[model samples]
Each structure stands twice: as structure tokens, then as C-alpha cells.
Target: MSSTNERMFTRRDFFKFSGAFGAAAGLAVAVSACAPADTNSSAGQASTGADASALNEDGTITAAISYELGTNGYDPMVTSAALTVAANWHTLEGLTEIDAATGETYAALASSMPTANGTTAEVQLREGAKFHDGTDVTAEDVVFSFQRVLDPANNSLYASFIPFITDVTAKDDRTVEFTLAHEVGVFADRLAVVKIVPKAAVEADPDAFSANPVGTGPYRMTENGANKTIRFERFDDYTGPRPARAAKMEWQIIPDPSTRTNALQSKTVQAIDSVPYLSIDQLKATDTVESVQGFGLLFAMFNNEAGNPFADVRNRQAFLYAIDMGKVIQTGLSDQATPATSFLHEEHPNYKRAANVYSFDQARARELFAETGLTKMRLLCTDHDWVRKCTPLIQESLVAAGIEVEFTEKKSADVYNTIDGVPGAYDVVIAPGDPSVFGTDPDLLMRWWYAADTWTDTRMHWKGTAEYEQLQTILAEGLEATDSATQEQKWGEAFDLISEAVPLYPLFHRKTPTAWDGTTLVDFKPISVTGLTFVGVGSTK
Candidate 1:
């Protein structure tokens, strides 16, 4: 297929770009967050599961997490680390919260769900709520939290999630009024994006507060991610609906899939996330393991800067068509994922099939490559274990299609560190991301990659292009439309536009596997997100 002026990855003088995984890829970085006493942290002093003797104390939970804290701290405003974000869910509260297991939004800090429609709505603070530090939760504190995230100067990554909110003002000591740009039916649900913080604590010492946040949630962070292990204690003063059932909790930051699996098998931790695909059946023998389908995905992102070979939409589309997604899903992922039919997985509530879907067509791929004069390309891939599985096969397909491949793998964090980001930074990048950990809304998911300056400007370099403008307009219409059918229609249009653009897109949606001891932990429902959640979970040991 040829189009008028179809820019191809051909000219000898032309440069190529790299692809990075979208924000919805859920794998954690290989490294853990900076810690003051990491080596000394002991998540378990318990015997192995085979010992037949119990040593863990009652009301205590231990877990091994595949995600590490990396350079980020515990602050909900900016930290994207999978482990830190999940931990925050235990130690923080918003006016409303989306449950980790059910995806249902419920009032947490607010007395009840407020009328989040219209340009204006008021929220009443939950009575007798107290912060981890014993300070009473008040309306002013809620306003402060929202303002800090909305403050452009703060550069909070979450600001993009609620662009409709114009301002937040405390109507009185216990009531706060939200001023929106327009009516938003999901307004209360989106508020969960910004976890309420204590103004006094945050202002007292911002750095200290980020490392160890104080909130009105069920748990208090005790370890601040020092020593590769994070510890939490149940906050007795918390007056929220989901009170912590465990008195103490310890999380071992184990990024290596094998080590994380062993930690659970050896009874070192009660639960673990990111169970390697091959190890799932083995783990099921000794523990309860479930692979939950979610919005997490491994994606290919292109460099859309002028002169970059992938600057042309045709090349981007051709790259997607080159891969055999059926084989990739079956062999590479152990049939653990669904090939992308839309930007979202098939399970997503707002999922709409895109205008264009890339199925493996080697003959067509070759035709596009030959049309564009593209013979050789460099690919940069993140070295996550599972990613290692898929990239090689993706490389194999391109090579079979008569393209020379210069493929390089690096730790996810290191890729961004060394990349100078010239016009074509290694032609393309394949990495993992999962922003659905924030919320599952179509607007929230699309904003994360399309409208966000970080992805569109710095990564894809498509911010000022005509296609970007079109996608943004469609997204705005969807978010502002209160009617369900109209919003879905607009969102479907946005998905179709992005589907054709393919600036950055998911290859497949992942089925995240999590394992926990059914006999030891009570009410421990596995989450489809990157890490583990222990809220309302207890231990019988």
C-alpha cells in the first residue's frame, strides 16, 4: 500500500528513531529505590512453607514485589514506581478511591460521593478522620493536596489526569468546593488520582514528606524504601472505611522474576507479583496463583521528529504489520496476553476496535519496506526478562522480511539515561508501561500517552503535528461529553485516529500473574496491577 508522499525509512542521509514501551506497561525497573539501610531490612524471619511450623506473628503480612522503587520516593504526586504506588494505596486516601480488585470507585476520605457533575460541587470531609501523624483531616487539607497537584509549577505528573478541574477552595473547615471547567460525570472517580496529603507535614519538610508521606489511610510507611525492603505499620488512628487488618507489613523489593518466585516458594513472603509465565503452574501447586487480564502492555513507540525514518506514518504502520503477533502471544508470552485490537485490551470497558489493526503480513511488510527503501534498522529494547522473550522474535520477523537489525537491550531506566534523543534515537523502542494503575478511564489512559508532554514531546516528538492536534481534539470531546454513548463514540474516534497514526502503540495487553498463600492470608485478592495490595488483608500466622 502506497500513499501520496509516504515518508519511508529509506534515504541514505535520513536518520531513524527508537521505540519505547507505553506508560501502561507494568513491569518494574531492575533497580530498587535509594535506601539508607537496605541490606539490614528483614522482610522475613519465618520458616519455609515445607517446615510445617508457623513462625509469622498474627496480623503480619510479608510480600515479594517484582517492582522496585527506583529513584522515586513514596509521594503520590510524582512517584511512578510500581511498588511505591501500590504501597501508597495502603497509606493514603482520596475523597474517592478505585478499589484495587473490583475497579469500583468508593468514598474513602469524603463522607459520601459528592455531586461531581456541573462546574461546581462540594465534598464533606469524613467525620473523625485523622492523618497518620494524628492531625485531623480537614477540608483545607484536601484543597491543598489538589492545588499542589494542579499547580503547573509543581510539575506533578498527575496534573494531566484531571485537566478539567480549574480550582479547589475550602468552603469551610469541613467542606471543600471543586470548580471545574465543565461538568464531568467521572469527576469524583478521577479525584482518586491525587491522594490527599497533610498540608502541615508536606510544608514542614517536603523532601522528608515525599520519602515518608503522612495521610489519612489505613497504614503508615515505616521504612521509606530503605535497604531494598519497605515496611508498614497499621495506623490505629486511621478512621477510613478500609482499615488495615494487618498490624505490620514488610515488602521485599525483588525485581528478578526467579528470585521473587523463590521468595514465595521458600515461604519468605506470603505473596508475590509478576510471577514468571513458566513458573505459574509450579507455583499453583504450593500457592494460589491467578493471571488477571489488565491494561498493562508492551508497546512500540516511534520517533516522529522530522527527518527520522519513522517520522512517516506508513513506516510505523508497516513495523506493526511486520510482527507475527499470534506466534508472539503463544510462544513468547505462553499465550498469556491478547494481541492488540485497539489501543486498549479487549477486556477494557470502553474498548473499541481501531480503524486499523496490524496483523502479521510478511508479504505486505516486505512490500512497505521495499517501497520505502528500508533495509536496515536499529532497535532498542528494555531488558526485562519477559521483554527479552518478545524482542528476539520481533527481531527475527524483521530479519526474515529482509531487514538488517541492530538490536540492543538495556535496563529500562538506563535506556532513558544514555539516550541523547537526537532525531532518531535508535529508530524505535520497545518497553513496558501501565498507567491504568491510576484509573481505567479511556480519557485517563489516552491522556497518559497522547496528550502528555512527556510522551508526545520528549519521546515521540509529535506534539505539534496535525495528527496530534486531531487526537487531542477527539480526546477533549470525549472527556467533556457527559452522555455515555457520546463519550464512547468520541473515544472510539480517538482510538481509531491513534490506531492509524501508530506513533506509539501496544503490541498486546498483558495478563499479570500474582501468587499468594490462600491458607495464610485472608481476603487477599490479587490485583491486575504491577504490584501487590494488602488493604483489608490479614494473616492467620
Candidate 2:
């Protein structure tokens, strides 16, 4: 197997499956109707002529997020990244939330579950809560905020998740009613992502609201600037038990991993998302830094609907066999990534052991290629360092297996844009797809890959089998088995059928590493799927 082909698979798997473990990862480019503004003017400048001590009476913590925040508004309904940053918002109230331990969804803002008929759900708003602007958080605001996501113009990424809801209305000052299109089991979990925003504030200036978001969360957005920084002030009116230890927080966008590491080491920044594999050992050796391994999946992707040489199952199988995943895992990832045996990570609750299925066999791969009779092929990839590093390993592996391979490197966005929206751009390309954090619902995964007819921006245009469709139906309606034992059986059957069809090739799971300054920080909890939560951070002193 050629190292080049192996690396190609790595690049694809790294991005596509990063989110499979339960948390959404990636850069979110904020999309608001308003133009960009200087959001850092008040950083060193105090508001109301107050001193830094007055603003942050106890302490302040600064965190460096790898990428700039994206198009999703501060509202959680739009994107998970926004919801992560707005974790403090729950200190105010949300419609619902997930229990961190069991992954079960529960109502937070509402008092109880919706009535059986599904016509309406009863909600009891927390009293006396106020938005940053001083507007009372009334039931009317909650209803309006939810309705905004349903608006087609908003084109919320979460639209499919809330298909059962039709309307939400305030029945009284503290209670609201949700009218449903049908009875849905995951409705509460879906609502967990809906952060309540002030109706008046959003309606008044939707664009400005993106830059200067105002919510009833425990933190308020204070400042933002282009390529500068975003600052937040802790909300003293927060009614939740986990009151923030730090009165002020700043998210400094440092795109370069090295710069972020430098910031942490120099005490200029307190914490950072995953350290690169190359830097892990060095970071671990430093007494000032604490390292946490995160749960994330990495897999290679093939555009079956794109109709290249790889569109043929035999060819894809040949490519899979021709590559050496074990060597790539050990070398390219520096032994940080684990070779995936099944679609889900071994650590996940429902994961099934299927090591034999993914085992590398160059002889078998050669036979598969001889049977397919495919020769020359092109492997499309991103110019990013990681992908670049893996591509050569894959190319070399494929060449060794009597297959000719060519490499093309383009900027990440450009590569995705060219191959995704259009068909037949290349024989194979690398990409990423994240699964929902709640759990690995086989039906949901299948729909995203085959049913939706679109992979992210790429039009998958899947030509699926009847069995796969039936499995999807079972996924949507088969949960009535009364226990997890029955549910697992049904899901296992579905995975078996899907695996036979080869809709996607499972690659090794990637681990995300976070580095922090241990001297200044006391505690940190790395949530499995959801990104790191600020709620876990505290002062050592």
C-alpha cells in the first residue's frame, strides 16, 4: 500500500468524522445581515469609567479559541458552536438541555413535557430574568425566539431537527404553549439548543444583534473587532447555582496553533483547544501546562454520488485495501489516533467491535484492484499542513499496489467548493462530517449520508437500496421497543446492512487534545462530544 493513498484517507476521515463522537467541531463563520465592526474598542477601556478591578471584582480568565466564530448567530438554535459559547446562557434559561452523564434530553425552561396529543407543550418561564438590555424575559420572548428559527429566511442548520414543531405561543406571563406537527421523542433535546433571546432586541436590529448579541445568559457580549478579540462580562443577575468564578472572559482568536501554545506558556492565555500531535509530548513535559485528551472521531470520505472512478464500489474497496491505515495511524498521527474498526468509536456506548472488517491486507487490496482493473487516479486534498502531511503517505501506498496516483492541493475552502458543489471533479477527495452529540442514531447518520441527498454543501445524490430506506424508517419509528436492548438490536441490524453497501468507509478515530496552564487554572472537565465548557474552569487561588 502506498503512503500517499493512506494519507489521503486520513485527511478525509479527520474532518468528516470529527463530530461523530458527540460534539460539533470546526470554525463557524458568523452570518449576520450586519457588516463587521470594531468589537475590541472597550477591551482595555473600561465602561462607565470603572476600573478593571470594578469590572471583574474577583478574577478574570482568558481563553483562546482556534478559529474565529462563524455565521451562526449567538442564538443556539442556529449552530452548536454558538451554543457552546453561550453555555453560560443556561445560567439564565433555555427551553431544554441534555443531562451530561446519560445523554438523555430534558426540559430546562419548560416545567414539564408536552401533552400526549402533541398539539401543545406547557412551558413555565423562570421569573424575574432579564436580558442584558434590562428587558424582562417574558413567555412572549421565548415563543418569538423559537419562531424565528422556523422562519425559512433564517435557514437554520437545525431546521430538520425540529420538523415536528409548528408554533409556540405564550399562554400567560410565565407559561407558553408549543403546537406540534406531530409527537416527537427528541423534541426536548432539539429545544436544548434554542437559547431565548429578547424579541424586541432581535427585531429592532437583527444585523447589529449578530455583532452585539444580547441574551439573558450568565454572560453578556461586551466587545468584538475584526481580527482583534471578543470580550464578555459575567452576568451578576444569573440565578443558576454555578455562578462564574471569573467576572470577565475574553475569547482571543489565535488561528495559529503555535501562537496559541506560546500564549498559554507565556501566561498570556489560560487555556486552548487541542494541541497538535507533534506538540503533545512537549506540552506534557511542561509543569505549567495540563493536557486533556478529547473524544473525537476521524474518518476518510468518498463522494459516491460524484461519479468518479471511485463511484464504483470495487474501486473504492481497492483503494481502501491498497492503503495502510496502521502505519498512517502510527506515523502520520504520531500514534495519537486509533485505527477505527467500526463506524463509531470503541469508547462510545453503542460501539460494536468489528476489527476484522477494517484490517489492512495489501494482498487482498491488490486482488480487489486487479478485479476492478482501475489504473491511474487523482486524489484531491487541501493545502492545510495536516492534509498535506498525510497525502504523500497515501500516494506512495497506492503506487505500490500497481495503481497510479496523482496529487492536487488547493486551499481547504476552494477544494471543498470545487469538488462538493460540482460532480466528477476528482476520483477521490478528503472531507469531514460530524454526528450529533446526543447519541449515535443509525437512522440520523444514514439520512445525513444517503437520504438528505447532500453532504454538507455537496450534493450526494445518493442511489441507495430499499434495505437502507427501510432501515431509515425503522430508525424514525422503531424506538417503541421499551428498552435499550431492543433498540440496540434494531440499530445493529441497520449498521450491518449499511456496512455491506459501503455508503462510507470508516477510518480511525482522532483524539482532540487541549492544553492549559495548570498554575492558574484549578479544574477542567472535557465533555465528550460537546466542546470544552467554561463552567468547568476555576481559579487556583
Candidate 3:
């Protein structure tokens, strides 16, 4: 397959999970009724501040983030948490990279991208690229990195992203070659998903390495901010195209929406991500808040194991139809999210409305419930700051449809622990996910929930069924198709099958609102994913 260099926007975004994250999308441009001129982030320039002292002269850019550090650590090979992946963006490098702000992929560890169409492709590492630990980057490190992710015993979540690659071999000290299982057009940009790490450091102490990995990127992580704050310092010897524009970076892990907004307002931090929809208008008075729409979604996943009430597709459809998605979006999300028409948001370049859309139909919902005799069902939900806003309304809608909802809300990790591998723990789960944080391709997005081993075999228990086999077949065809049109058609068929299957699906694709003081932090743009990035940003303070 002839691959293009685009990853997330083209192919670079990654972290495929329905977990606690604040990340992307359509310009849900937060233009409150009384908006200020400076708040228009679409103006395409940094928003300047009047308080010169608030700017940092020490070249430090501080931010308040609403996402909690998930149970996982910062191993790019295994870490799927939004917070850690965002940190890895600055502290790690792929042979190619996705520009956080622009969604464009460019070579980072690789000096330049070579042209190749067949199974074999060679990558040349940039000369003199050094890890934060002062070790030189080598082709061997790149090979080791890919090998670990491909190792089945490791069971890296990213292994699903590049099933096409059979092996990665170092041709020389600085040159590596990729041997593909098959031809893939996205081979180049998909390289961003596996961030290169120092093999010596990782193999020496995998635990310590996960705690604070050493990489070839512009910044090195100092504090992981388990309960307090995360910190980074510039790698002065960095010789990459986008060096750290600041001397230091600090991210206050404030998961409370109100507290995060207050921190940004009080100037305790120069920027904040996952800005509450209700707080956007007021904060816009002082900061630049842009709600970019990405593929981030609030999903409804059903336990489809045998004997589970939701094992019946009709019950799953009934539950989805019962939820008044319109009110949920308008009131719970403050109209900051779009009701999902497909797995992908409508704005997604590859989106096609699923054949069956569960628009609010209380009567139809009741009809299906009566047919399936699903009177009482347990609902599992996560307490992620933003997800909290909608779960109550979801419960009410289900109750309104005459089904008893035994609602249980926990932190993202707890919710997954309750359901992962344990069948029938809950009939349905309402949570957040943004696989687009991984990339924008339909294959990557669909495989995240449908084809990935953990989600298919454990969480939803949809594997081994005829429908599951059919969906998998369609997905494989989509990935195998050489032409774009045929691939998209196959993907559309997968969406149609998923719509009817209803094992797990999206309720809506959300907008990510991020607040940053442009005057204090120069050239910093909000991404449509869950974490905050300050890659090319410089602080006036």
C-alpha cells in the first residue's frame, strides 16, 4: 500500500480508549451572548494580555488541566491515558510526528521521509539526536521500540494500530527498515503511534522508565504529577525542528472544572484545558477559549455476553433510543457536542451517517424494552469531570422510558476495572473516548472499539459472534483496499453493521474547549483532544 505522511490529522494522533480525557472538533466556537473581541480564537493569532507581569520572563508556561492521570504510566508503547500521551508528545518522538496544534505530521527522529510503495521501507534517523538522558538515538532503539509494541506478550494497546507491520529491522547504525505483513498506505504517518524510546533505559528498569521515560524530543518530563502537578524542562541540546520554546513547563492536575477555570482566571496558570461549557463565556472575557471539534465521543457500550439482557441487539437499541440525546447535548453539554450520526462525528472527513440513527423515540424504546422484557438494568458510568455532566440525564432518560436504572458512577479506572474481563457487571456503560487522539483514519477509529482485543474479548464481550465476525471481515477489507473509494465504502458498510449490532456505539462526538492566555504564551493553540500541549509555545513571563 502506498502510504501518505499524515497521521492524526494525516495519521499522528493516538491513545485509543474511552477513558478520562479532555481533548478536539468542529468550531463549537464558544461565542456567548456577550462575547469579547479578544476571545475569538478563530482570528488565527495569539490573544495578548494587558498584564505584562502575568507573563513569564523565566520562559515558563504553566497550565491547569482537568484530566486526571489515569492508572497507566508514560510508556508510549502501552500508555493510553490522555494525560500521559499528551506529555509524551513533547518528551518523545516517532520517526514521524503529528503537529499537536496543526494536526500535520512531519519527520521528527527521521531526518527525512523516503519514498516507498511495497512492503519494504527504510527510515534514516536524524544525525546527533540525543535522548534527554544524554544518550545518542540509534536505529537499534527504533527497532526495539517497534518490536516491543509488536510483542504479543506485552499486549500493548497500540499493537492494534499497526497489524500490517510484520517486523522492523535496523539496516545500519542509523538506518531502519520496515517489513510489512501487507502493503498499507498509512504506514508512514502511522509511525507516530509508536514513540521511540531508549531500549537500554527501558530494559534496564521498565518500571522507572514508565515513571519517567527518556526520549529524543525537545522536553524531558520531571514530575508526573500523580496527585499534584506535572513538570517538564527544556532539553537544551535538542536538535529537532521544533525545540522547546520555553525553559520549563508546569501543568497543575486540577480535575475540578470550577477550580481549573478559577486557576486560569486568577492567573495562577496561563492556560487551562477542558474548560467547562458553562464557564466558557465568562472566561472568554480574559482568555482565548476555542472549542475545536474532533472525534472525541461519549459512548454507550453494552455487555453483549450470552444471558446478559443487552446481549439482545433490540435491548441495546432500546436503551440508546431511550436516551434523549438532544436534551443531553443541549443541557448537559451546553450544546458543546454534536449528536453522533456515526461512530465518527459528522464533521470528520471520513464520516457517513450510519444506516440506523437512534434519534429520541420514547415509544419505540418502550416497544423494544417490552419485546425484550428488559425491565431493570445496571448502568455503569465514570466520574470524569465532563462525563459527570451527562450521566444523570442519561439515567433519567432510561428511567423515563420505564426501565429501572441501577446507576453506579466511579472514576474512569474503577469503571473499567469493574467491567474489563468481568462479564455482565453492567448492562450498559456511559463514558468518554477519543481515539482520534491516536489518528483520523476510519480503520484506526473503528478498530479501537470493534477489533482491539481487550474491547472485543473482555469489555463488550462481542467477539466470537457471527456479527462480530462480519464486522471484523468488513474492517479487514477496509484496511486491505488499495483505493480510497473502495476502502471508504467498506468502512460505511461497517458503520451500517455496527448501527444494527448496537453492542457498543457513540451517543455524541464532543467539542474540546481549551483556554490559554495568548499574550503570556505565544503561538500556543488548543488541540481538539483531551490533554494540553505547549510544544512550540514560549512564555512572556
**By TM-score, who's the top model here?**
3
Q: Stretches of candidate 3 above 4 Å error?
A: 1-58
Per-residue CA lDDT of model 3 for 44-83, tens digit only, reads 2443443444445357888886665545567887777667
lDDT of 1 by residue, 1-541 (tens): 0122322221111111112211212323211111111112111122123222332434679998775453445677777767667888888999998777666678999999877656999899989998877888888899999999888788777888999999899989899999999888788878888899999888877766766677888888776545567788878888788887778999987768999999988999999988889999999999988767777788998888888888878788889999998888888889988899999877676778999989899889888888888888889998777888899999998898888999998876566544534555668888887777667788888888888776788777889999999998998888889799999999999889999898999999877777888778866666564677776677776
Tell me the tens digit of each residue's lDDT in model 2 across 1-541.
1111111112123233322322222322111101001111121111122122333336677777554443333445454342334333423346665533234455555555434355567777655667777767788988887787777777665454555678888888888888876565555666754678788877776655654566765666565423346666677775543456677777776646788777777778777765666877777676233222222334445656544666666777677777787787677767765676665555555667643464677788788888877788877765433444566777788888888888787654455556656766766765433444432344344444544433433533345545446756666553434466766776676566555555555556554455666566644433332234454245543
Instruction: Give the higher-TM-score candidate: 2 or 3.
Output: 3
Which stretches in model 1 have alpha-carbon errors above 4 Å?
1-58, 419-424
Ranking by lDDT: 3, 1, 2
Off by over 4 Å in 2: 1-57, 71-77, 80-93, 99-108, 111-120, 148-154, 164-167, 179-187, 287-295, 354-356, 382-391, 408-415, 436-457, 463-468, 479-482, 529-531
Q: What's the true lDDT of residue 393 in model 2? A: 79
Superposed Cα deviation of residue 332, candidate 2 (Å) = 2.2
Q: How high is the CA lDDT of each candidate model?
A: 0.76, 0.54, 0.77
Models, CA RMSD each? 11.3, 11.2, 7.6
**How far off is model 1, as Cα RMSD?**
11.3
